[model samples]
Target: MLTSTFGAPLAQKSARAKEITKCIAVFMAKDMRPFSVVENEGFRLLINTLEPKYHIPSRQYFSQTEIPALYKQTKEKVIQTLRQANSIAITTDGWTSRATESFITITAHVITDEWEMLSFVLQTRPLYEAHTGVHIAEILRSAVAEWELERAACGIGVVTDNARNMDVAVREAGLAPHVKCFAHTLNLASQAGLSVPRVHRLLGRVRRVVAFFHRSTTAAAVLTSNQKAMELPQHKLIFDVVTRWNSSLDMLERYLKHQSAVAATLLSPYVRRNAREIDTLDHADINDAEDIVKLLKPMKMATTVLSDEKTPTVSLIVPLKHMIESSMAPNEEDSATVSAMKRAILDNLSNRYTDVYDWLLECTALDPRFRTLPHLEEDLRQDVFRRLREKAVQLSNKTNVTMEEADEGDGGEGTSGPTPAAEQPVNLTGTAEEAEVEQPPPNKKTALEDLLGGTFTEPAVAESQVYCIESEMAKYKNGKPISLKSCPLEWWKENAKIMYPLLSPLAKAYLSIPATSVPSERVFSTAGDIVNVQRSQLLADNVDMLIFLKKNM
Candidate 1:
């Protein structure tokens, strides 16, 4: 056997070698590096220098053994954590990589018993089948079973984009309480507005101007010089993508920011002779851009808020929708193009989101920050609270059933048949002495009082469960809303046990839902890095393990 100068065999499984191999695997997964990185001369030298006795494994060793083992171990830990979750909400989306291979990514969001929000990337499996609704539905069902989420004690909802196929797939999978991505809906509406001929033409001219600067090095240099001369922030122009509406807004904002520099650069004597293709925006166009920005600024803010993964955002959808609708309302001072654009957006959004509105409204009402629902009218507000109270009663009943089942599981309560109730006051509001108020004789009742069931002090019946629910609702209603900076989970953690036990669980169910498919979308963003040119031929199974470990570990 070959031996090093120190006389130990080079490839023996020492502790240091095992630890270094584990570190190398983690580096590949977490940093999105190709397995072959270990084989690179520079990387090999660095490892050897760090630990002369340690042997660097081949790429085959890491890819075949180390990565798979890491993924399996990390997956077990994630599954354990997920099993502890009472309610889970999922976000899933499909992506096509640079290799032209299709894949689906699923991410799970849960609110722990302690009211802390956690998210985990479940998988990113390559799709060999057609991207049909039935196929997608099957994939989703398999994913739920694989993750052990099908047996969730409470609800399992899914958030997805507004793709018709996704809607069909989620419905087919029977993941009730499906919510369309609010950001996607906003983008659809914005795209519709941008399709108006006048807006399209204006944007075409802006796109051309931005393209000119991007393509012409001389023109870009001139613009930078002009920016410095004008004492402006040296910001580069943003190019918009056709698929993303926010990117258009970003481009327009950057264009407007560097308007002075751009105008000077385009009008420079040398540029007039050299690059005559650049278009100049007139004053009216500038005003139109400003109006469009003003109209879309609220939506941009709403999108940012709903795309939040760290905080609860499903509750923000309805409130943010109301705000955007108000902003889109026609103003007398609006330009024709702006007015047309607003109408187009409103028309597109008019009949949308009807399917998920009820539950999202419930989420809004349950969220303490927006419980009052100032955006809604008085009657609508009442309706929301009514539905909330009804649900609370249902939840209470379900909890009772669950507790009973558990008791039965514990050996039939040792043949007690059923436990006896404590002889406490029906309202549970008075002391023991106060609850034992002296009752008058039956004959002391007046005729009217006897007909009406009883007098106020001596009620005829016990307090109904409905009344108890109403009291809890009232107490929750009277609470002052927490600040916008406070996390709803943190607030619930503080109060769920003692203050509003019944509603707090319901709050977790509603608030755990994500408002967008951005979690899965983010996974694709990382996937792009993993499946780049260097690793394009990576196998689908390896890709799955790598992505899972990358996100989870």
Candidate 2:
């Protein structure tokens, strides 16, 4: 009877009731999980479920502005936590996007004396138009001050790559002595030292040949079938020069074992094309191939040498020097070949090994102040020479031993002597007048000398003055524990105010704590991680929030 009178209204009411039931069920499901554990997941799910209600008629429920307000509230809390840290270090680095807009990210972290890393803040901003040192410094200072750490003594270090602008900015900001990233330096040195251009070009040719064979399905199948005919199976292979060199050497040695199959494979139509290209290669290419083969031949010997568990008794330099001496020795027959090999080795060393030796010498000659504290200067020097001698020995051992053994053994057990100390030879041509340099006066006290003071004062000159003060102070031994009540506080304070006017700036400088660049470096690394390509769309406010959250959490 009720439905007959108000059936349309009842249907509308029933639909609304179902909607309410669904909302209640979703809310209850979300509430059952720990709030912190499921906040993000639950929020996303709720947003998806409420899609229709957002535009539904006769409903004015949730506000869109509330979500943003909640985010703001959380961000503020994060900022407060960062501000509470005692000290923070910062890092900053510049990044560019595909669109070519440059951005700078600054990161802050709190450090403890025990070297605990606590992430503090990370912020990204559009690199300012000027991008000058001053401008960069201002940006960094603003970011640090934002966290209320502008005056905090907790900023112990800054770390950065060797960029002049970034380094200058760090110094201008009064964050001195920044540590250049050691790992980056090592990588750069290794890349420069080990990347042989000739080797690279040879490897490139190998890659091209491999690509030609592998690109076509027919060529790959032919190569595979041929490999199988030779009692070998084709496998996925890379055109690594080192790997290929070893493989080629092994195959060449076993040529008699598989000569028929090898001949067939090489004469194949696909192989013919590769061989034709190889045959037409220039003399330089042939030399490169020979050189590569020769260089790699020593690898087997090198591996054998490395496998020996015992450290070689002889130093590296001695063996290498001995090898050079032996190779250069006069021979009745094969003299030309010996001479050519010796010259090639010498030329290679002069070009490649000179810099390494120079660097070692420079490192060894560094001031005693820079030497490792526990090791004495003599010990440090010995250690360096020992390493060099060992490497030399290994190189010398690589040469043919039988022919040169008699010649080398002539010098007896001590055949190869220690490398002579590298000296700065004086120019004998210079006049005596030119050699005589001016010297400072002996009485002129250096900063350190002044700080140390005289060994003993002349007693006659200042004795009376010291005795008068001591004698007067000795009378002040009242039974009441030297109470100030027995004497005027002003008189006592005035008498104690003796000034040391002779103190030097160096002495004053020593009183301050040693500053390091580690803090700046860490900040730069953190900044790089946060403002990377994947997160480029982050807005300024969100970036700030993320930085604050990272620093605190």
Candidate 3:
């Protein structure tokens, strides 16, 4: 009767309704709500006060029965999603809690055959074993083995910070050369710039002023009163976090926003007792802070773009690195501190990111915006394209698609089925290629082809109206490049198999890596939030299940 009148079912006893309640339990876990809320006395009283007839399962039933079943089903789905990918990249990091408990998190990134990007939290379990390189490698191998991706056919890349421990661990795991987190590297370089004597002195005074207002109630009240007297917006000072310098940027920016109020607060007798001589930030000091913001703001935006989990970031690495270097140049009239900071940043960039562009050369080349590689020297530019074309041709030898098959328009030339239309058009603005380089020597082969054994048959180059991978690449290089505004993965969806069937897989592989282990670090932050003081007694197994379901769902 209720369903007929209201156009929605009201009965909670139906099978589908029960399933939904179980899903609600998982959602609560994802949001970090207390499980006992489902059946606590206060909760029951609140619900009874509103709708006494409505029903919900007891906390014991949901916690002990429904959640386990939900986790099992979700685990199977996560595994199935992983199985559909041809390659996977991994990032892992260790975190410590206030109680000194150690936890490790592992995250995976992959691009589906249809060119959809995905990232999932594979595991976030306690570390009972020692922190040796061997133990780290063992945990890494177990996670990879669970997804059944141990072979060269499922090539894996491991990304982490430049910490010596992680470096030792990657070598022990025997994966490819380590891919350092691009965002983390930028932070390190930014920190170097901020460490210059003049910049450091400027930020030091700002930090002291913020600390006074943050800690003393009298100081905070005086600032509030002063802002009101001036008819200014009410706001609190921001303090830079000691561990992360990015917070320092926020602190400096916020201090500038309310500089008038802060200066007025210093005049208030209530705050004067706590204020030090260093607390007197002058116009010269304020000018230095403004200069620092101009230098750091672009770096901040770059970090955000590279830290994204929903988009392909590896392709943006080379281009962003170049963009940052070109953006931080100090003008002749700039302050001495600003110029010194600029040189430190540039030096750090040269020393650290030289390794980055080399590793990501192909990814940059594949991105339509960077197809010509404007930043590289002429000789190195030619060599990058040469190796890329070689990899494309070798990948083509392993596929069954030919130009004629693709031309027939069956739509299964390189994949198992047809792709749905993309949400955005692939930009076809101008050719991505600069000029064609000589073909790779016939002796060349990809690491996967070498590991998995040679291709089944070697066809003679260009026979019987069949398409060759080299020819496809040559044709593609001449086609118009896309706008930088377009999504790189969407462009691949439109043109990967459609325009260059044999080379699409190689392109997807290059774009699958996350630019930083920031995703992995962010996973640790989630785990930290889940395991706070009140929930300290939660078992490791339960924590793992909750984190996995939360991320994978």
Candidate 4:
């Protein structure tokens, strides 16, 4: 052996070289470990460092065959995980990617008496075709069956947004008894109400003005200058659903406050002629500027009230009740101002109040079987009838149209003259029979006859008996006897068909469940977070896996 710098060399150089190679190979073998046990955190860091320096040959690290295997394994695991749930509700929606490929995301909520979001699964199929009801149902059914849940009693409910296709899918899947998403219903109602002609006109004007200010730098500067001059708060022209309504009201309020500034802006040479046209626009009822101000004041007040932390306490029934009571017995010293206010409120109540009442009545009529469900049916029916009755009574009383029973026959006197009945003290505690006999017939039918025929008959005097002896009494002053008719009762009995269907659980659920798109919004938000630009290249299975893990684990 000979010394070669820091080490010794053998006499046989070839043998020595082979020995050195063997030692190096042993060291490298000792350093190697199974990839399965490796921690992902360090692996990710290593991959990141190598990604920019030297490409490890694209498509080599992730085996093409492994993807399908992993998906199969994951699918099995997910199905097993969800199998333990007693009840599962599914929410689904479809979205198209930038590549124009449609994808349907299905989120399953496992509810065990207490509702909770359990698992979210993105189906493997690419929904490339048109998103119709039949297609959605087919995809959903396939996914459910793939999980071996076709016959599973685990699925009890489904909550979704008000997409016609999605709703159709849910119904076809036989999940009708589920709670229809109330939040979605509310959104629908809000959208529908916002789309009304009056609302549309107001919104359109505001939108145009806002767009004008935003589109041009000069107009924006002018608006900013006006804002500073008027001491108005700095707010952008962006339209938010609730905020825009309030914002329009605010603009009107501000315009009313500083009419001169608005007038100056409208008349400015830089402002477009079309923009200035709003100043000359005449509303039919509100003729003058003062009238416009008056009209807007109440709306502004209402908007402010609604914006408060506490929800406003105005009910569709309360104002009508008060008006009816007032009309029945008007104050002796009613002033013109009071009379005008009353009339205005009444007119508003008359025009707007009925829709809400009609909606409520429709809500009550949702369930014909609701009447069979203990006190629920009666309570709902009575409440709806009560409000409607009150409204009708108010209208009738204000118009001074008496709704009462007609007298049967005249006294046996030979005179064919009209005999009037004097106002008698009403017996508040009188028996039903006694009241029925004393009161005049509200219509042509007899009370006893109608009641036996399954109708509520008003109190009426007997037709056969002669009242000559009673007529001779000085207390019996002549006046036409007005019959008392409960309009609500009549309406209820007459519209039973329309009302019963509305009272059904299905109908009540449909009505009570707000027509909103909140679920779809939530789904979109969740998708945005999960499928970001950075993760755009992720495999569909991995995307589903990531969402499932993040949502569940």
Candidate 5:
């Protein structure tokens, strides 16, 4: 093949396309005032060699025209992707920016025919009305309609924080089955655990100590030097954010890790001048900090496991809830404040999540890995199993025996291919010409089921009911729970269709429920970066466009 030149002649782009391109580039760069940047002598000089003939658009063009056009295009694509889903779950949360503007993020979760998981950030619209249950529900309904999911065959559910307003909103929107974010619940428990007065005082002192080191380069330098001399790792001091639940754990862990270095640094003349008596960590302070960190590690893991979107988290909800609650009882070796914290956590989990276990039991009961119905209270166990079987049969919507299709000219089974012997044939096929134009045979069950095994040759009701009974009965076999590391979705995707056909739909439905609304909360973290001091003047509409493109594109 002949070699082509490094660059080739190209047609000039339309002003609108060029404008959209520049605004997206600038928006993604987290920059404000595109015109100023484009007009800069250095910026112009750098881009000159790459595109000598092109000119950058004015800020007015980007703000007024390009952002709106780009948003419209991206939104259409998001809707198209959403329209293909058999079911949809949503995760939403609200945030306030440094600009003091309130915004809500909504993301849709869907599972494809091949058992692949996908998500789309549907909207990051500003919240103009009061952020109440009714208002949030209204916005959610609009988002649902925009994606045409209001009339969607498979239903929609929302995962959100356990905040009262959010709890009220999903119910008001008629999207409830009590699917609060497990990760957020864990955080709240952690929060309550730390609320004991002494522990609270300890955390306050820790933050102050960290704050002193955080803003002081001299203090950090002295600490690092001491760490080097002591042959310890020179880790940075961790600071806590008010909104981040685990920040205190992180601060304490880091402080304890460099405990000796910090002690040495505080004695240095520069630190002595700045640090107060309260900033110093005594032996008791160190012990309390260690206890807090030890208690929080498992919770952090629980948060991480639930917040994950790549794997199934819904199945882990009940099991992890049990794990978290069992860990809440304090050992006798624990200090008085630490004991109080554990009891508080225990109380919080019991009160806040009394109904959650029942909701999650339905999910766990359907999972093949953790078929531990015994995990549920004895009174509720059988009911959960009954609900599982009922749910599967209902969702399958395959209650009646299927009418057999005519195979031969006499509507006969004489030309038997693979039809099961149990269901005798009944001719449903019409005239040859009409049959030719018909949609694919309704003999096939589910798309996922077909992937595991072919169309059902047996009568539908007998087969579905058998699978339903088998699924409920499977729970009593060997009461051990699966490893936390196991992926229940993969187990079902690989085997459930063949083993428990009726329960497959239930498996897919509950497995697809999102464990956390962190996807929406994560959008706000990105929003914080996008709307910083440098780009403080970014308009609300354009900010929405930039965020949409950043995520969707």
Candidate 6:
């Protein structure tokens, strides 16, 4: 009767109603909101006020229907996008939910033909079996098979954290060309330095001082008042997490910023009466904290840079290690304690990623920015170049077969399948609305120079490809590298086809491999949010759908 008076309400299957429901699912995935939010009185009220003719669905409708539908649709699109990639790299990691459910996340990194780096969260499957290497390998193989990427690109490049099981799993899975997460390695090295007895003791005392502010309201209030009185930024104390050495640096740095306020808070009469139980940092502790912060600042910066997913990082491993080594070197003015800390960090940092040294060196050499490989001796650089020549020959063999087939055509003179549309070179102006501009052309070789130094063009046959690759290598090496802040991928995008066709695809293969498993770790971070207390009852499959949508959609 009410519907008759107000006009028939929207059906659940109506376009308007289904659209709203899909949005609700998207809200849950994007904000990590619980599906039960639909059951909340205020939320229902808001919905009712917004659309009197529409009906809100139950949480079950979203969890069972809308989310799964969205997941399937999005996965299809991701798969199609993956097909367009010339090469890809894989990163995977494991996590345990609050409900004691174990999940493993897999992610793929690829560079678009236009050179835009894209990362896909492929899956976050719940693990029902043991966490043994063999079991893990099976799961990995299944993920690759499910994605239909078993033979895609230049073979799978797997990256995982520096865990024993991860190492065994990659080997067991036969996913060769694996890389240990460089960020994890840096953390281990940084922790080794922080574990020095002198630094460790100093940090503990400082931790207690920060804890006092957190525990005692009176102390915290006094610190705030002192900060205003002393004209310092209104910043709170930072409590360091044991696992993240960077957090320790953050705590010490924040404390140093408000050292005067903290000292005044400690001396406050209200604080002192309560301070008998608290241990405060002394002058020596303060000095040590300052020195340690100085030591760790570079490590913190390296972690920040390498953890970024927007840019290619595999090529950065060599250069960053060089920079870290230089920073960890002892100086004449160093205190005995600081000197010891330096030794500890260098000791742990040295010989890391040794298993992949040759691979890393190859990536470094191919990167135009670091082609000179200033960090290595001349002989080491020469050895890397030698490998590059061999790799060029191996790649040329593969290229020859494809070219021959293309020449033969599908039936007569044309290749099968529609030719792919050409991608517009990246906009130097950083906007499509702006007038189209030409990619600034590279320096041209003079006729005499071309004759003497060989033209930078594609080889006509397999036999000449090796000689052409050598000529391209010489030109690349002699050419001035772009600025340190410039993007190597962007440079290649602009010049790859015209200047170095043989090496361009090789760059695509190597540069797509990330230096860390941060992409997979990032998925688990989203998973943690999705599988929280309110949603603890969510089935593993549901959790996977939510996390996959949260990341991909």
TM-score of each: 0.88, 0.38, 0.81, 0.43, 0.79, 0.88
Over 1-553, each residue of candidate 1 has an lDDT whose tens digit, in order, gives: 3254545735647787788899999999999999999879999889877777778888999998899989989999998898776568899999988999999999999989888889999988778988888899998988887987742124478988888888789878877578888899999999998898988888899999888888888888898999999999878899999999989999999999999899899889867666576678999999989888888888888888877787899998888888777788989998998999989999988777786687788898788887787877888887777777766655554445444544654664422121221111111111223333233223345677777655553342234666766887888876788888888778888888888777776788788889999989988788999999999999999888988888889
Give all candidates' CA lDDT scores. 0.80, 0.39, 0.72, 0.39, 0.69, 0.80
* Per-residue lDDT of model 6, residues 1-553, tens digit only: 7577667888998999988888888998889999899999998988877877878888888888888899999999998888777566899999899999888899998889898899999888877888888888988888777875543124578999888888889888767578888999999999999999998988888898898889888888899999999999888999999999999999999999999898888888888988876666778777888899998898899899998887889998988988898898889988877999999999998989787888888888778888888878888888777667666555555444434444555643533232211112211111223313233233365677567644334333545877888888778876787888998988999888899988787777788899998888887678778888888989888888888888888
TM-score, predicted candidate 2 vs. hidden true structure = 0.38
Candidate 5: where are CA atoms >4 Å away?
A: 1-43, 63-69, 151-154, 273-279, 377-380, 398-483
Clashing residue pair totals per candidate (backbone < 3 A) = 0, 31, 3, 30, 0, 0
Ten residues in sequence with the least summed lDDT for candidate 3: 421-430
Deviation from native of the Cα of residue 288 in model 2, angstroms = 12
Better of 2 and 4 by TM-score: 4
For candidate 2, write residues 255-274 as lDDT tens digits: 32333443465468866765
* Residue-level lDDT tens digits of model 5 in 1-553: 1114433333337664475465546454344334246557886676655655445566576567666676688788887776555457788988888888899998888776566677788878788888899888888878876666542123466788887888778878766454788888888888888888888888888888888888889998998899999999878989987667788788888888887888889889988887765367778888888888888889888887777887767767778878877887768787887789889888877776565566577777766667766566766877676555554444443222222333432564422222232122111111122212222245645677666444454456457566656654564334465665776667666755576555565566666678888888888877887777766677777677777776777
Model 6 CA deviation exceeding 4 Å by range: 399-460
Model 2 collision count: 31
Best by lDDT: 6
Question: Which candidate, 1 or 4, has the higher TM-score?
Answer: 1
RMSD of each: 9.1, 23.8, 8.5, 24.0, 9.9, 9.2
Count of clashing pairs, candidate 3 = 3
Residue 196 accuracy (lDDT) in model 2: 52
lDDT of 3 by residue, 1-553 (tens): 6446445643787776576577668766778755666767876677555544446777767767777787888888877787677567888888876557788889888889778888888887678888777788888877876755443232467888878777778778766536888888898889998999988888888888888888889878888888898887888999887667688899998889888889888877777866756366777888888988988898899888887776678778778888888876768887887888889998888666454456587777877667777788878877776666666544443222322333444653432332121111111111224222233234446777576544443433434113466676666655577787788788889887767776677777677878899888886677776777756766777677778877877
Off by over 4 Å in 3: 1-21, 45-65, 151-154, 225-232, 276-278, 327-331, 353-356, 398-458, 461-467
